[model samples]
Target: MFLTFFEPPADGWHVRRDDLLDRLSREWPDARLVPSAEMGKSEMRDVGWTYDSSEETVECWSAQSGDGISLDGDEGMVVQFVSWFRRLVPREIDVTFCDDMYSFSLMIPPGSSPGDVLRMYSETA
Candidate 1:
């Protein structure tokens, strides 16, 4: 699965870059950051940093007004990432989750359990 964060039209996003980096470091200590030059040469668009581990990747991208995180890994790891992510960003940030067959968006409120989100997705998608 993939998850992205973006500001609503004409609104400010609540994601703090420093906090995000710190959390990522804590969560994936073994991941290595792919250099900016390498990122530029890759197929990704507007990606700030791409952190890679043996079995997974976390790509960070930025747009005019917001940041995005794309996570690719096993289902358990993805869910764990989402649980931490939901607690990292403040309430009301626009989040989009996508998979090969489904793409869905929601404003996941602060304190919304990851399990709840998963259940909701299963019901809807």
Candidate 2:
């Protein structure tokens, strides 16, 4: 599995890419957290809605996993997990699952602090 974290902007409250990767490395040492190539660039088009004013942008991270082809959970279970994860942190973090990509976006409140949102997602075996 792969993971990464970002740092806060030099002049803004946004989290920077390097900081995030560093944090993730400490948090999940076993995981290969790489510097996202899409950082500072608009890679994935925004196709969703957010309610947080602090979240200024989103980042994309990719990895190769042959574990399975589908996420092992029902819709309700996924929603509950996401809701609980959001409450643990102050910033808004949304996760998206596509064909082969698991995307997460950090939504910052207008006056929120700088840091990547932390949340746990589980897949059943």
Candidate 3:
């Protein structure tokens, strides 16, 4: 799964993640999207939402936005989330996702035009 974060543009409105997900789903019914769920019963370090797959689950934890919990080894859900999220959020928001031992973060960087991030993952059932 992939996780993307968008710092509201100076002129853009600020919307909660939940609301964002809902709007995306409504606008794109074909997109497999949902608000990430907090990791339940798993003791990982990191505070962020989770996305899961039929075989594995992946977790995306952001130190800046996350509560500082670590989500290691939950690769499946994390990958799934990231992939679905990129397809949902506006195509102009920054995002991140974890894959294997590395994590990919998408950003517009400083002084760049508003942008978005996209991460993709694939797993067999």
Candidate 4:
């Protein structure tokens, strides 16, 4: 899966980065930090995740607007990660999802539940 977080404050994002990484580590011990260079950037870090199910890849990159998180892992695990991520979004943001089959986009308005967003993505794609 490919996912992007649109227009998130770069500075504000750092505050949540560690905790999120920690949670991912606790959940998926094989999970590890992904280097930004490998992510096609040199500034972003602590923004990748991996699990046992997939081909052990965690791709990420930083843009002027926000961050990107991509996984070639299990869809269910990615959905859980996305659900936990909702709390870290401070405002509405554009999210895009893509797979081999289709790509979908949606605006995650403030106060919207991540589960709902996941559901929408699932239903659409």
Clashes of each: 0, 14, 23, 0
Candidate 4 per-residue C-alpha lDDT over 5-124 given as tens digits, one digit per residue, 9 for 90 to 100: 545454555325555666656755665565554555444434543444454333332233335554555555555545544445555454444553455665555555547766766787
Candidate 2, residues 9-118: lDDT per residue as tens digits?
34334333344345445643443332434232334321111221232322224222111112223433333323322332334332222222435433322232122222
Per-residue error at 39 for model 2, in Å? 12
Per-model TM against the reference: 0.59, 0.27, 0.37, 0.53
How does model 3 fare in lDDT?
Answer: 0.39
**Number of the top-ranking candidate, with TM-score as the measure:** 1
Write one digit per residue (lDDT tens) for candidate 1, span 17-112. Answer: 566667667876764565568656544434354455567555554332335566665545555556666676666564555553456665555675
lDDT of each: 0.57, 0.29, 0.39, 0.51
For all predictions, the C-alpha RMSD in Å is 4.1, 14.1, 8.7, 5.0
How many residue pairs clash in model 4? 0
Worst 10 residues of 3 by lDDT: 116-125
Which scores greater on lDDT, model 1 or model 3? 1
TM-score of 2: 0.27
Most accurate candidate by lDDT = 1
lDDT per residue as tens, model 3, 1-125? 32344555556644444554474357434434323353443433223433444565544443333212233435443433344444544555554443334554443232222121222232221
Alpha-carbon RMSD, candidate 2: 14.1
